[model samples]
Target: MKRRTVLRGLAGSAGSIMTIPALAQDRYPERPIRLVVAFSAGGPTDLMARRLAERLGAHLGQSVVVENKTGAAGTIGATEVARARPDGYTLIVAVSSSHAIAATLMRRPTFDPVKDYAGVAVLGTVPMALAVHPSFPARTLQDFLRVAQDAPEGLSYGTSGAGGIAHLSGELFQREARGIKLTPVHYRGASTALQDLLANNIPIVMDTMASIAEPYRGGQVRILATFAEQRSPYLPDLPTAREQGLPGVVSNTYNAVLAPAGTPASVLATLNGAVRTALADPTMQAFMASNLVDPFPDPTPERTMVFIRSELEKWRPVVQATGLSME
Candidate 1:
């Protein structure tokens, strides 16, 4: 009798659970939503977040604001989201650096990237190209590798930080190519590294497309190859490193949406729908193109989580192998 009673109780609970989504879909975002960007304002990630905020607010009939809470390689912003109310009002749009390296970088992070947040959607990846000052004399990936292999001190590459995606990608390239030894020069920001690269203080830099495009077009730098799987539409002449024989050289900075863990599943679905709508808007699409960011496909919750997990696994070894840490 007790067993039957328990089974009936379980059926009742499952039926009620099914109704929650219907209830949530009817009325959500009773207040304005906050989208937090882990980095400072005016960068690619920030721009995307702000654009998303405007579109998302329009779709949801509420004001969505983007707040910058930059620090400690995105831990400051992530921690704030992790501790937020989980009422679906607060969201974080972040890159791989925050999700993959924060735990390993910090001596003690306030929150676990995976445990503290639910992966909402991976916006899209921004390609990082291997560029060298035009005066360096390397016109192709092979030529650049050959020179680095021959150099006794190894070739120096500049990146934004010690454990950043750029730093890890540089180390990955070094290991994959085998012959070349790469010495990383960490900078406070891409702009600083770019300044040094322009001055020829650093001959090479593995930097984002947005950062290096102007200089490359201005004849200050030459792009050997982009880290994307295929040649970029914006730079068709430049080959990918993978096509140049280093198949493992695929690297990009991916941005995604994350909400505090245990947020209602209904809220997650709503946010995912909003992301898809925002990314597809013609004006937003034009903005992304101008910025060299590709809009991601299928912003489903499952796909987003799978992509983040894959990225985390992909970079974990590179981080450990390179001995990169925030400390």
Candidate 2:
């Protein structure tokens, strides 16, 4: 009887061990998920994360909470997510600055943008707008160029920070515009940059359309041109830099979702599906449209990874040329 009992006990223990992973897979998200935004609450990245979290929570049947961990050009929050458990509960809103630009710009990057995290879904892409205060002398791109060329010191432009996409776009524009140099005035974020522009502290700014949309519409700021291959649907009348004789000056920033590397494939798939559904919703589309951001053509993890890799490669030389460091 004792020998028979021992055998049964061993069999039960083996069966339980086999069922553990299956149970975890079945109950993927048994709790609320945390979406980390590496920027401040009012920034574009945080806005996108909050909007997506709302619909993602509905689709996943679990609450999705957004936690802002702003600092170090968005690396603080990204590092937090990179070191998180690969259970799909913790994710990060990855941006071009935090992932692509920072990878090369930062002297000592805390996380490997590509290796430390697995792509979940791409939220969208927004073009950088070259805008100026309404009171500024230049109203058109030509006028701005002429002013920049005539000025010995060049035109001053404000950016969110030194190593961000906005700063890079300004640099690229200067390189492509020929004889047009821009003195960069770094601010804490786009909002602050916009504030300085409104106050006439800075003559121009290169920032996301969403950041300047209200001011542009309110007649406080004027958008001279967009840094994109083509005109944005939201600002259809506005011409792109390519159309304005700066062919290679196109720059568009994108936002994406990422999970810690080694996350279960099933969990990643579930998250991707939820993101796709959320992005397709009409309300989400409207929000994106209002912000002058285009929905990503493909929101899948594989596509996101490919896009990220391409971006990283594309920006490596650009960052190197700038010799910008965040150490």
Report the Cα lDDT for candidate 1: 0.85
State which candidate has the highest TM-score: 1
lDDT of 1 by residue, 174-248 (tens): 988997789999999888998999999999898988778888888888999999877777777889999999999
On the 0 to 100 scale, the lDDT of residue 97 in model 1 is 83
Q: Which regions of candidate 1 fall more than 4 Å away from where they truly are?
A: 1-25
Which residue window of length 10 is worst by lDDT in model 2? Answer: 227-236
TM-score of each: 0.89, 0.86
Query: In model 2, what is the error at residue 317, expressed in angstroms?
Result: 2.9
The sequence of per-residue lDDT tens digits that candidate 2 reaches over residues 150-266 is 999778899998878898888888888888778889998788989989998888899988778788888999999988768877878888888878888778899999999999888
Decoy 1 TM-score against native? 0.89
Compared with the true structure, all predictions reach lDDT values of 0.85, 0.88
